[model samples]
Target: MNSNAIKARKKVLVILTQSPYGNALSREAIDYCLAAAAFEQDLTLLFTGDAVLQLINDQNPSTINQKDLTKTLSALPIYGINQFYVDSNALEQYGIDNDFCVPTIKVDVKEISELLVNADTILNF
Candidate 1:
């Protein structure tokens, strides 16, 4: 099937490596997905590399002039974007876990890259 047709009947995966407050792209990407979910789109979120920082615990962010991404990540379920994922080695390298992040699957870079290629539409933020 073509890309739009695939997406129409399948899930959307968003891979985020950008931080919440350093720039607006990350936040915008998430907000756009929320909007997509609002439209009944099936959505999944994956965190890897530096993006794992988005799930770090208890970030007050005021000191760094950033919004608390943890809050946004925690709200995924309410928005129906609950199929979350994290690279296993990235979690080890970044020191994170399920409790500190959205419900996630353990995936490595190889599988992750494959997921991107296979996805009807892969969005990186």
Candidate 2:
């Protein structure tokens, strides 16, 4: 690599599709992203399909007797992980409004495609 070349920061786009319960994968993803963010990497998260429901507000997994990951997701901003994104139509399809997601996360279906296209790395879970 040329010393003068602009080394782009590692950019990760994580897609959380599965629901946030029953398994540890959801929380794992959140931790992975936050850890990467701690390294000053460019990290972003997206919610699509049925996963949009995971962003619903006031989530209390205790109802199912499991740990709650919603609060963890909400605390991403404090970890330098603020570039969260969610599909607008997916939210509508799942009947979830914007207030349920990370604060000021840009929501849109088509725009999400553009973001994915521009990402250096993408992991769909």
- Highest lDDT model number: 2
Residue 16 in candidate 1, Cα distance off native in Å: 1.0
Each candidate's root-mean-square deviation in Å? Answer: 3.6, 2.3
| Tens-place lDDT digits, model 2, residues 48-69 | 7766767778787888887778
**Can you write out model 1's per-residue Cα lDDT over 1-125, one digit (the tens) per residue?**
67776555566778888766777777787787778878878777777777777776777988977777777767767877777677788788866665665666779889888778777777788
Report every candidate's CA lDDT. 0.75, 0.77
TM-scores of all candidate predictions against the true structure: 0.79, 0.85
Q: Tell me, by TM-score, which candidate is best.
A: 2
How many clashes show up per model? 0, 0
